[model samples]
Target: MTGPAYAVLAGSLRARIVSGELAPGQRLPNEQELSVEFGVGRSTVREALRALASQDLIQTTRGVSGGSFVSVPTVRHLSAHLETGVALMAAAERVTVGQLMALRHLLEVPAAGEAAKHRTDEQLEDLRRAEFDPAVAVGEATYAANQDFHLVLLRATGNPLLEVITAPLFRVLATRFGRDHAPDGFWSCVADDHAELHDLVAARDADGAVTAMRRHLDHLTGAYQQMDRLSRAR
Candidate 1:
């Protein structure tokens, strides 16, 4: 019964917020004003604001100059939003691990090629460090270093949108998967591959970068299968 009216009101306001009409830190009209503006009751306006608040699109302040203001979500915030949703969807069997891997390949392969040409010298140095900056511990440091390598490559493409959409995949795999349990030599092999990838990027060898990235993904197939088994066990 409340869906059509209040949901519509929330959608209308959400549109304005997303379209830059509302803007970050901009205070929305008071409840009474919003109700009048949307031709709805105060309760409807309240419900709409509640919806936006739940989605992290707005925040309400309680002081003298307080009201709801547009929330400026960080990249982490946006990626976190996808994390729970995608995690739940996977749990519900609506998505498969293979499907996620495929999508990541679609995104990351091209990104590797792009990064080879676009990456700054500073980013290239970071890649070099990320490949080699692990301690003589278990695979934990190596696992972290692996994550850093992919993050740098995606960021090197200078595409914020790419990083936002794909980071959760790596996070979900690392957290719920058996990456920490990767065998002792596994980390060293990963480090070696990363070093090769670094050289490719430094050489501006786009073709070689793509080939190296694809082979690296191929090397991960067994690890991906291990994660799939772990997910089912949970």
Candidate 2:
């Protein structure tokens, strides 16, 4: 049998949105108008709209001068969905820690070089704020700082798309395989690496930043692999 009528209508509307036939922020036709256009009942039109809203493809509002409109996907929205998908894949063993690290190496090393070239003064300060003294910070604070450093570094590249692509991967790795699995002194090593990376980027040393970032990721790869192994074995 075929899918429900609402699903079919939703698919048609989604195609329009994807093709840019319905531009972002462009209000959709009223339910009655949609019903007549699609040759479906008004209830089917509402259901289709609801399905689109749930997927972040459209938004609906109530009251006068309000109706459904196509959504403009933000980096945060896209990254959250990507984070969920990656987390699910990781949980199912389809994405391994090694694979995640490899992807990071591929993307972030070059991003570091770009950051060194394009980072603004404000971005450098943000990266500085992400650093912490492992001697003083422990547990969750350490993890947050480390995550922040990479996020700031990605943002410093003057490329929001890099953050859009890379932030979710960091999030999936951290959330899926808890940070508590690292060995003694791991945080300290991370602290040093982040500090060195910050300095290299601040100095606009593209080559140095690239080298430092690769080395930093290499240092953490073993810890992440250990965590993945432990998580799988359990």
Candidate 3:
């Protein structure tokens, strides 16, 4: 009962923050005020605040003028949480890393096919910019941009659920592998693949687009596996 109540209150507060009703950096009302406003006990408010703090959405400070305040969410925090879950799943052997990679390939291949059928010129332009920029480095920037390219593809699918599902996995993979370990030639290879995919999409060649995406994922899997092996050896 307490758990569900606390979750509800926390979710309500999170929604307010996401919706901008509680702007970032703004202090949350003190426990007494929140308890009165929510018609809940102070303990429940404290529980709810604890939940939000775990999500990196809020910070609690003590002393005079101290209270709960919204904090900017960082990708690193999100990635850390995601990596923990992925590690747990792997450790249980309920889901192997290979299985996860396969799932990604299955979803993304068809997604690329769908995108090829429905993608807009603007989305293609955005992808081109991310993939072809010569000034991008081989570390964090490259990894971030690589993730953005996939996100652009997912967005081109126009499926909100796909974005919601894949975004976390992408973040975890980026964090786990680290930017320096990402394939040095990632951008060039991905650019070539994207160009081929764009052509297939423009021509409404679903099969060709799917094939191109599969090939791209094949390269990614090989690179990731190689990096894993290197890390273990080290």
lDDT of 2 by residue, 27-123 (tens): 9999999899879999999999999999999999999989999999898898888888888998888988889989999999999999999999998
Model 2 clash pairs are none
Off by over 4 Å in 2: none
Per-residue CA lDDT of candidate 1, range 1-234, in tens? 246788999998999999999999999999999888879999988888999999999999998999999998787789889988877876687877677778788888889999999999999998987876434744466667778889999999999888889888877767655665554456667777898999999999999999998888766756676667865676
TM-score, every prediction: 0.85, 0.95, 0.65
CA displacement after TM-score superposition, residue 112 of candidate 3 (Å): 0.4
Compared with the true structure, all predictions reach lDDT values of 0.83, 0.89, 0.76
lDDT score, candidate 1: 0.83
TM-score of model number 1 = 0.85
Candidate 2 or 3, higher TM-score? 2
Could you give the C-alpha RMSD of every candidate to the true structure, in order shown? 2.7, 1.5, 6.2
Each candidate structure's count of clashing pairs: 0, 0, 0
Q: Ten residues in a row with the worst lDDT in model 1?
A: 132-141
The Cα RMSD in angstroms, rounded to one decimal, for candidate 1 relative to the true structure is: 2.7
lDDT of 2: 0.89
